[model samples]
Target: MRIERKERADATILHADLDSFYASVEQRDNPALRGLPVIVGGGVVLAASYEAKAFGVRTPMPGREARALCPRAVVVRPRFEAYVEASNAVFDIFRDTSPIVEGISVDEAFLDVGGLARISGSPVEIATRLRARVAAEVGLPITVGIARTKFLAKVASAVGKPDGLLEVVAGTELDFLHPLPVRRLWGVGAITEAKLADAGISTVGDLSRFGEHGLCSLLGGGVGRHLYALSMARDPRRVETGRRRRSIGSQRALGRRPKSDADIEATLVAIVDRLGKRLRTAERVCRTVVLRLRFDDFGRATRSRSFLESTDRTDMIMAVARGLLDDAMPLIRDRGCTLIGLSLTNLDDHDSIQLTLPFEADHGAELDIAMDQLRDRFGRDAVTRAVLVGRHHGDDAPMLPD
Candidate 1:
């Protein structure tokens, strides 16, 4: 499951992402929630209605903080089954409109309508109709981006958010993209933006003027070339649908409170266990590890590492996840924790048993495998992490944004 980066910018594609998907769904279902700030998550903010967003409440924010921002906001727990049903309905619309639809997440997808121009109307028309239909039938706000390429379409959707529709005309892509901040570029993260800002390149226009050669020297050969081209509207990438997603990940809110080291470790192991089982079931091997942590103070951190070989072993993933957690111990201790997650990438189709290191043989791999099998045959609750058994004692602890 390789997610190929957009190599060119001429591929006609549209990326449609729901606005505050979970929270919007809840609000839509509950009449009393209309026009009120709504936050979704058990202990943390999984999604926030646009009304909450105006108050600076955001996903992954601690529930306490979200409440502080919008004192009158109503909080709701996530209804995953309801979300799945809504997502299926949305996908059904995508299928009827276009045959090439690529789902990026539960809330977002890319639609290829190059061949549907005559039957489905223009891309802009299709996007408008789709957005209205989603609101009418699914009772959710959806933002759409219609562009000549996937990257630009995704960027457009991001820019026109909270139930917006934006189109980057084929020839005016550069004009539309240049004024935005450098962070709007897909790969330009905090660190990269800092580097660009250090070089007096603050916007896409500035980066474009910096030229590919200069950017290559600043951002390495590969990134510099790709970004400069994107800035200049020279992308030629295609819309790839049905590409198997490389990873599946989940996180839980621990509530906005300090967690003991043991509690954190237990949570990490549980997440790794869940993700590892999914990887194994997919018959996929992942060579990269990703860790995400959210702190009580509303700060966020992420770390990733690449492995020489791919593996789906719980022990292996957990061991690496622990190492990553250890690396972030100082920050976690200082800020306290709210949420943690794990994801594996760089996936391959191979499902063969990988040889274990001599030291790893003692890492409880056998027991974990046995438990996964038994749980698969019996039920998820048949075997539970011992730490969770007595967690009621710590129930009074701070809550993370659920």
Candidate 2:
């Protein structure tokens, strides 16, 4: 008797995620840390091991709290460089498995294994081999989830946490998802969770049972309908590399508090200079500048300006950011700022420069270029702003791109 093979449509996509990435890396590197609770971050928990997570430790929680939860937990500062290296190695393995890889983050990716079933065995077999290779070579544990759609594949991986594998067949997605809580839907946070709870809509089944009109009446049109659609596992999004990030942003903590205007200006200028160089290196230009401010009271505010034309000029970016600062200065003063950040959005990829307005009078792009060249030739510290040096004690030098 001939047995029928599983349909190719049933197993196509795979979501691979490293298990407790940072904490696992620390434990893998040091044998003594194995089987013990591990929390990784400088002053807080960037990642908590499964062992520590049992005690209610979580990422971004204070290190003191994590230690209090699991007194035997080994706390280690984050080794970002090491994590990046391991991520690259794991990605190489992903590329070997399939060409259609979509990276969600450094530690997770969606792989299109649709065409590989002919030569590479079934999706389950491929996932097993991929996980084994990563464990044997990269020395890290990872979980793999296989499903017909990207959304369900990610949910499967989440359900199979900490080095497990789960697969949901195509027609069984609703059966697998409806029993879960509404919080499982993307963009449903604490606020929305409470709102859903108030409406007696707790699970995905409840949301589905509420029907479209009921959802619209309760949560309004857009978000309510969106959740209703997802409750039925109706996502049509694909796993393609076509979706590139439109903008890149970085934020730094001031640690204590900022004092003067000039000091804040210097910090803003440095950040803009760094961000501009990165944009140029990526050959992209941004038409919008955003300034983010976090007050001592933990309130955050953002101000943005859209430019008529896109430019990656360091001085120009800072000038716009400074203009945003002037607009938000009163609020910043009223609520003393604890953190300041800069971001450039509205990006166009590798486009020709569209010069509309005249460049600022006092600014010098040549000086910026010279500094860049010096940093390229000698080192990042070869050039520096005198104001940034020794202005704040224990302040480290700006990081140069590798």
Candidate 3:
């Protein structure tokens, strides 16, 4: 039997990404900050304006280093509420533009406009309108890339950044992607790029010529096959909406200074507290507690413990997370800790748990509910743990919906 493969005949996928999202929002709200180099967050650079980036400033860089790089840059604390409101407004516009919209993060999304050609005109027209709408309505600049495949669309958006629009027309995907450096590929990070460079493969065209067999021999089979497929423009992914997350997590950067055990434990408590509240709000329970640690040398380690049953109780999850942290303390002390993070994985809906008669009332559960109510009525600062009193926990970074 002979089978014919079917593919979309036109470029209909759009990768819309906001330019320097946090910094852009800061610039949009404050007229005085406009056209100036801006850096968000004081301890660690969360986001940098295009002007600051021109001077080699980047996110996650130490504030001290960034200041040295761009002396006149204006540093500001992140206003998460404003960023969230802006993200919601932009997503609303995305939904209005296309019924099939997949949100990647707070600042990026993939929109599929495959069947709207007759009514909405071409993909280029739709992308133009989307960019204009975001600038006029949200008062923020956004760049959009239109292509037949999601990978190519994302690549195009990256190539045409800082409020630009680019289109990779059908039948010209290879022409557009091959000349770019291998680093432009989605999964090629610093280590991978170094490895590719060692092999004398610098561009996508070089990678394609290396062939899948050669790549599999050079790299591992899974990664080699993935990159080879991308080099050939063979992505078949569809834009998905209403997707659920498998894990919920948060982290805090503790800077380069040495952190005492007490300080690290306190930070863990703060992260667990926030994650617990988020879990209950989303009506999800998790069965695994994972602790992530980064050392001053940039090496990373992870520790995790699974519970017998899924739980949304703050105390139970905290107990497990603390245990994992305790186990990792030796490594942390040896390497000198730089960051700590926690993740609740193996998630399931709260409704899925079977109800059982309790021998005794769950005081911890009651306390969690009470604290959540108090924070809801008042603000997040209304309720704080005794250990967290007078301690600066830093701002919570915004995340995509769990």
Ranking by lDDT: 3, 1, 2
Per-model clash counts, in order, read 20, 0, 0
> Any runs in candidate 3 off by more than 4 Å, and if so which?
1-7, 399-402
**Candidate 1: misplaced stretches above 4 Å?**
1-11, 42-44, 62-64, 189-203, 213-223, 286-335, 350-379, 390-402
Highest-lDDT candidate: 3
Per-residue C-alpha lDDT of model 1 across residues 15-59, encoded as one tens digit per residue: 999988888788878889989988887577888888999999976
TM-score of 2: 0.85
TM-score of 3: 0.95
Give Cα distance to truth, residue 170, candidate 2, Å. Answer: 2.3
Measured against the true structure, the TM-scores of the candidates, in listed sequence, are 0.77, 0.85, 0.95
What is the C-alpha lDDT profile of model 2 across 32-125, one tens digit per residue?
9998988875344668899999999986565666788889888776676688899999999999998788888888999988777789988899
Error of 3 at 42 (Å): 2.3
**Sort order, TM-score high to low:** 3, 2, 1
